[model samples]
Target: MPEREILALRQRNAELESRLAQRESDDNLYRFLFDTMDEGFCVIEFFDGPHGPLSDYVHLVANAAYARHAGIANVVGQKLREMVPDEADNWVARYGAVLRTGKPLQFEQELVATGRVLSVTTFRIEPAERRQVAVLFKDVTERRRAEDALQQLNDQLEQRVAEALAERGLFAELVENSVARVQVVDTELRLLAVNHRAVKDFEFLFGHRLKAGDSLPERLANFPAERARSEAMWRRALAGESYIETIEYGRGARLRHFELRFNPLRESSGRITGACLFIYDVTRQVDEQQRRLQAEEALRQAQKMEAVGQLTGGIAHDFNNLLGGMLGAQELLRQRLEQGRLAEIPALLDTAGHSARRAAALVHRLLAFSRRQTLLPQATAVGQLVKDMVVLIHRSVGPAISVQVQCDAQLWPSFIDPPQLESALLNLCINARDALPAGGMIDIKCDNRWLDDSTALALDLPCGPYLCLSVQDNGRGMTQEVQEKAIDPFFTTKPLGQGTGLGLSMAYGFVRQSGGQLQITSSPGAGTRVDLYLPRHGETPIARRPPSEAPAQVQRAAARILLVEDQAALRMVIGDVLEELGHSVERAEHGPAALELLESGYVPQLLISDIGLPAGLDGRQVAERCRARFADLPVLFITGYDQSAAQGDGRLPPRTQVLLKPFELPDLVDRVITLLG
Candidate 1:
């Protein structure tokens, strides 16, 4: 040992101590960092073969947190492939890159083995002692879920926005096409949008164009009160309030009712962005209310006319009864005088009798017009009916108007009252003659049709099959105003003395009562067409022949007669008349008395009974009783009431005769001889 060798050795030992201390300090710092880090830390070691190729990944170290997350114990020094087969190959490649390059790498990946999203950073550390890769991983599952939730919310928001926009577009289109006027404005009361109707109407109202950025139109100022109300509404709407109100806008000369609705449009931040104003014009509705009040007035007038008809019908019925007795007695008086030495007075009596017959015929016409006369409704060929009317019409009109028919042979049959229908045809032909003045053509056309529901509804009729009989005239046409009221009773356009106005009205009523409809169409310059729609009927009708014409005459008869009547005045007159006619007569007030007389063995050769009696036994019932007992009794039943009551349900006695009230004395006497003989 020399002195120089000792100093050199001592210097080397100091340097070596310093180097060892620095290495220990660096190791302590790395340990502290690994232990205190919040991030999970793990180290993976890659083994190399002699050929310098990587063999496999081995887990060399893992923090306590990393071990807990892996759900394993003592994972240190375990091969990664053996511990987690699913993540082993991927981690080996990633970690080997870091270890070989010594470059840091960071990426986000999902750990398949743990089903957790993670961000991992890997780097090589401490190459001098042991070669390994250190990886730091942070669980990112909650972050990923939050991002997914935000994305879903964004998608939903976009969908809602699209739906809202589509709804707005639909609303805009509806307002543009609506009869109502519509406008939109911002919170500042500046106009933003206006429907075409609103723009046109406003322009017409204000006499100006409405342009963008323009101030409120001058029309708004005309209605100061409405404008004030509108301003208040807009203020409320801007404050996020919704309201509905009816407003009147006018300039003293023009006025209209507008139903206004105000709504606020809000943004995502809950601030009012604009306002929507919807306006609906209710002028037509307002006008209709006024028309209803006027209609009420007209309805009252119509009711008054209906009351008059009821009263007239009742009076006429009673009058007919009295007339029948007078006519019957006069005929008997005339016949008796002719048989006596006072035959010269018979001519005067015959003249009086003839006047009575005329009055009776007039009563028949009254009953027919009122629709109270008995009708035997049957299916008659419309074309045939029209053709038959032609010859009669020519005579009735006296060659003034030519009667023509344009009917098809295939025209369907209709259910109608033949006699009354014939009378109606006569009345129409007479009217046509008067209208022509210089002669015109009258067309009677028949058609078969099936009216649909829409047409029937518009015509205010039943929806079904029908047969139409149309009467068209080339005479003077009526005005629209006249046609509207054509069916009103006694409302005639002719001169006051020229027409009664009931011809058309009676026809209308008759058609209506028969479950049918009538329509009249006329223009001022064009021809008039009167159409009758009758139900299609199937039952056959009895053939009708042309009417026979004859002068009024009374026939004489002789018999032993039983007369039954409830009215004392009528009973006296009838008994006197029968006695004057060379007949032995017995009188009874009711059916029971007549039956009592018959039961007592006072069998008369003839029975004459008034149909309506107060004893609850009518003339028909008496006839039924008498025929049942005698089986072949000659009976004649007379009535001022409905003839249908005697015929309904086959209630009339078989082989019995009937006389309608207000009959001529000749008709009654003739019926008696015919029945008895």
Candidate 2:
């Protein structure tokens, strides 16, 4: 019995010893693993504390990593309240919940003691009644921050997408409701989008429906001209050019005027993407402008007709008055002769002669005012001419009115008739003298003026250099009303019969006819200033005036002459004068008769002819025919026309002389003798 019991006991002891040895080895490995783990690991045991039952914890087993993650050293067997007393309350979510639920809990929280965020997992250990839990955690501060940033980015992207959609909706609404036609096209002229108005207009104009994504060239293929025009404009806009232009569509009554605005679509980098066209109809505006222009033209025509009527009426009244004066004078002469008042014969003849001279002067002035008077323009030294006439002007104005003449140095030469200028000067002085009844001052001045476009327009003359002749008088000035009508025919400010009233009118017309301007500046109680703006001679070289010589006079004897005249009385009187002057005379009633007489071998030493001849030839033609037979024959023109017209705007031909009608008999004789001898 003792041998069997001893063997069983020995086997049991060997088994127990081996089991104890394996257990110790496993414990050592666990300890090594726990100490070397990267994550902080600890075993916490719950206990009753100041907070309440099972409300606090102590670290029963903590690895070396606990200090690295939790920033607390010597954690083994330490109460949480003792290790981190300040942050002990912050871990209220730990151990208690895991122990109650017996489930693993995962959470992230910042360890205020170390100022680091920790990701933590904790669970109740085996046999939960012992009130211990295992906690594993790692620092995750950077990872949590990145996750929060990602969430924010997702929210912002959603909001931006919503805004883009709203903007697109607004753009569509604006295009659909706009009155103008709109189309957006890419650089290749492919339509990206189009409004309803543009589609309708395209269909109406080109008889085809227009749609988005349609190539513009394809839509306008049937209309080659339209395609070319649209393409040209579209290319410019696609090249980043924005502009407004006008376009016409349809024809005649169906035509529409459209204002087109082009805009370019560009990218963020200023790269051109597309072009947009906005077209608005402006047909009504164009039609209105045309109607306004037509109305203006019609109004101008009506004004011209009214002006012509006034001028014609004035001419008839003045002409009849002048004719009556001449007729009355002639009737008185006849009565005196019938009564045989020999002593009064000379006085009656003087009266008739004076009336005749007045009639002639009236005709000349009327012609001047009408701007139909002939002009003989020559480059004249105006300053020298004014100086020469100062003595005459002073005499005409009289000693009571002091006349001051001042001319600018280096004055330009004016192209004008010297006699007419002299006559104009005398007329202006006389007017000034009349104004100066109380004997004021008269200032005659001349200077060169350069008129720019605006100044010339104000003066109603062409822009150029000019010579200004000014006549100023410090006398009783004309009122606004009087100055306005100063250039009108028969308008006068003087007492009855004292002034002809044609002074200003004649001067104004004459100046205008000579390519110049006449301006009057006057105000009541101030003074009157008349300025004559004459065109400067265009030639650069100053004209040197030759010394003037008197016409040569010859003895009136034994000179043969041929005369051609149209009027019966004038012809008879001229023939009698020629015979009395001891000249052989031949006469014809018209140019044809004169030519016929000349063809009959009647070649006289001198040819005298009237300008207003009948039968298809005037004095100029008669002279030509007469001179063909008698070369170098001296020809005398007796005409009512002024020398400006009789010579046809040029110097008279060789061996020619001109005498206007109503010229003195003695002057005529002198002319004739000079030509014949």
Candidate 3:
């Protein structure tokens, strides 16, 4: 056998031994990995079963981690039915597909018996004869739960986004379709949003187009006034001051009116970021109101003209009757005097005198109704005045009509003419009596009132305290037409000659002249009420001393009187009358002449002057000039003209008196006597 042959065989034997050792080592490593692997591993062998061919399988082998994942210990050599009989068919059908198709499959399933979830992978063993499948799985329940939760969160977020987009779209639509102009601006006055109406109106008003991101003021730059004003209002809104405004622009045919509402635009966190303006055109409404005001004014003017015409006609008729009476009486007296019938002359003279007195009385009432008569206003206790008249009223109205007087315990004092107020009260009472033809009740009420601004405005009087004296009668009352003209002079409901038509008019005038209002409230069959609201004098009145019933002393000392009359006839007549009264008289035709007499050291005890003089100075001026020299001179102003200044607000000089013209000689003498005393 040779040495070379021995070497070759020895080498081959060593190579075979090395290959066997390496194969054994690889087998041990594979076994160790299979047992300690975290994933559960198993092999299922299929076989013929009761359900049919290859209907079930048994666990041929399982790794150590198989029990932890599948919760089944000693799973090797266990049939699927024996291990989980309730769901054996389900497992067999799932793994049997791998054997029949020879395809690998991967899936996760719950092991109900162990209450564990297993992720399993299976494939058929290589040989068709060997019906087997291998599976690798892990308990993936926690991972599946986390993935489901993430998916739900993603769905909610998507839904929220969709809702937010829908809301924004709705808001935009609302603004665009609004009839009024709507715009939103940032703090920088930049246009953030604007509706179609706002854009169109802005173009119409300022002849400029509007768009988002454009500065509003810049668009109105050419119209400086509108720009400045609009910016001011916007700034206020931006500063958190919400307000409303009415604006008018243009003139005549181009005039337009608009109502604007401004509000601050705020974030959801309540931070003011900008402002919004809403504007509505109200040109038609404004024009209608203006037309209404014009129509009302025209109606007022027409009614005023109608009243004037009525007043004129009434005055002409009354004056003509008085004139005819006086003229007829004078003619009769002249004829009787020519015939030398002294007895008939006295009767004719009496007739003429009676006519003259009636004419004078008519003139005085006319003056009172016109609020032009002389007034010596002083604080008066009107409550006591009304109380004093109750007895007279009761007697005048007869026993048929019941008379009642009610006065406030703390009635406010009033500034008014005492004689005029008494005449007014008596006239009102007499008028009330006439209303109650079948005898009704007459209620007199006097109360204090504090007029607020609204009441004062309605009554056309200043707001303040007032004294209210009312006369109410339960009679037939008056219609609206009659009540409206009830206060008019010479307007009466009674038949001719029975009523003078001056009672209510005189009362109203007297109340008005004393800074008061006269209101008449009446309705058909609701009775009549006349309320006199005189301004409160704000002071307690002095107690009035009762007049003595005794006559004035006839035997009085002579007084030196200065007669400053513009009319020569009046001077002569007045001078002669003073002389007849045993008084010395000096005459002057004008104020300058009278002052000259006074300057020449002729100081008269009384100065009687006409208020409307012909020369440089009037009666008031003459008296003022005369008093400059003779500080204590007593003055008596005689006039038929308006002498409002001397008596207005009761501001007459001390020791001064006023007398209206057409006075009887006796009345003149009485006034002279009183002033001299």
Using lDDT as the measure, the top candidate is 3
Per-candidate TM-scores read 0.33, 0.36, 0.37
Candidate 1 residue-pair clash tally: 0
Model 2 over residues 3-44: C-alpha lDDT tens digits? 889999999999999999776543433343345434577778
Ranking by lDDT: 3, 2, 1
Residue 667 in candidate 1, Cα distance off native in Å: 17
Candidate 3: deviation at residue 441, Å? 8.6
In TM-score terms, candidate 2 sits at 0.36
Estimate, for each residue in 262-312, the C-alpha lDDT of model 1 and write its tens digit.
777665467776766666666544544566545543443343333234335
Error of 2 at 24 (Å): 98
Q: Judging by TM-score against the true structure, name the best candidate.
A: 3
lDDT of 3 by residue, 1-677 (tens): 68899999999999999999776543433443345444677878998989899988888878887888887788898888888888988888888887888766667787777667666666565565788776766676654554464343221110001111223332343245444577778899998777777887777777888998999888988989988999999999989897899999877787889998888866546778788787877776566557655654454334333323334554566568778888998988888889888788767667776767666655654454344335678889999878755644665666799988889898888989975786677677777888888999999999989999999999999999999999999888899999888987567798865654667776787788899999999888888899999999976888623222222347789888999888889889889877876889999998889888877889788999988888778888888888888899888889884456456465778888877887666667777877777
Runs of candidate 1 exceeding 4 Å displacement: 1-384, 542-677
Cα lDDT, model 2, residue 315: 44
Sequence-dependent TM-score of model 3? 0.37
lDDT agreement of model 2 with the native = 0.73
